[model samples]
Target: MKKYLKNYIWVILFVIFSIGSYFIGFKPGLVIYSNFNEFFLEMISFIPFLFIIIGLFDVWVPKEALEKHIGKESGVKGIFLVILLAMLQAGPLYGAFPVAYILCKKGASVRNIFIYLGAFSSMKLPMLGIEIGYLGIKFTVLRTLIALPLFILVGYMMEKIVGSNFKVEEVKT
Candidate 1:
């Protein structure tokens, strides 16, 4: 109980704030409620499907295969592969964390993982269609071409600064 409570204190505080806002007036409270409801609905519709895919990926793909393809020695091929994978994915930014964790555990390089995350956050494939529709194909293409190199640069810089062996740090009580 204590562990759960400690983990969720922010949620509890947010709930309290929401309730207080409700009592104070509708403009703030009702707006918050409506936004929360919309976001929750979207999350419910999207996140489960993503989690199922991640679970299957975790179970089906062998660590050795991941290592061979995306490990430290995989070179430029690994960078391109990771970017392609990230672009192909659908879901919120939060969905990337589990996939990143799995990749790290399975021996993917830190630089490639960082590149994957940068692409995932900035350049989703599905969103490109919408971007081209609204912003024009030239604009979309230019943005992607520019961002790809920057993301790769960031990945390399991060790896250089943090070292390749960086792993998820455990939280202590």
Candidate 2:
């Protein structure tokens, strides 16, 4: 009960502020109320979709399969594995959380996970397709070619430097 209350404290505060604002004839506060309500509703609406996809991924993909292909010991194959995983990833950057959690538990290398997510966030198929559509193949390819090494370097630095200090319980960013 305490945990639940703590988790929902913001929601409670928002409701109180909203009701108080509405009764006090505060127009700006009402604008905030409406905006917060719309954002909250939209966020809530995606929960089911996120759960369905995560659950399916958990059920379909085996731990051994991921470990063999994307494990810490995969050597040079890890790069290809990360790219493949990134290519197959779905949703926006935040959507990687569920898969990341699963992969972490399943012996996926933290280093590879970093690279894969970096690639997913930057060079996702959907993003690439959109870029190609808006710009040109040359631009898309050039952008990707440039971004690839940067993302890889970022991933490596994240692993060697940031990983040492990071706590698994809270989000880093």
Q: List runs of model 2 lying over 4 Å from the truth.
A: 1-67, 164-173
lDDT of each: 0.79, 0.73
TM-score to true structure, per model: 0.59, 0.56
TM-score, prediction 2: 0.56
User: How far in Å is the alpha carbon of 152 misplaced in model 2?
Assistant: 1.1
Global lDDT of model 1: 0.79
Over 4 Å off in model 1, which ranges? 1-68, 169-173
| Candidate 2: tens digits of C-alpha lDDT, residues 6-84 | 9999989988988999999899989999998887786566555655755676567663454457766776688777766
Mark the 10 consecutive residues where model 2 has the least summed lDDT: 164-173
Q: Considering summed lDDT, which 10 consecutive residues are worst modelled in model 1?
A: 59-68
lDDT of 1 by residue, 1-173 (tens): 99999999988987887888888875877787789888778667655665675567656645444335887788989987787778766678878888888788778899998998899887876666556655778999999999989999999999999998898443333
TM-score of model 1 (CA atoms) = 0.59
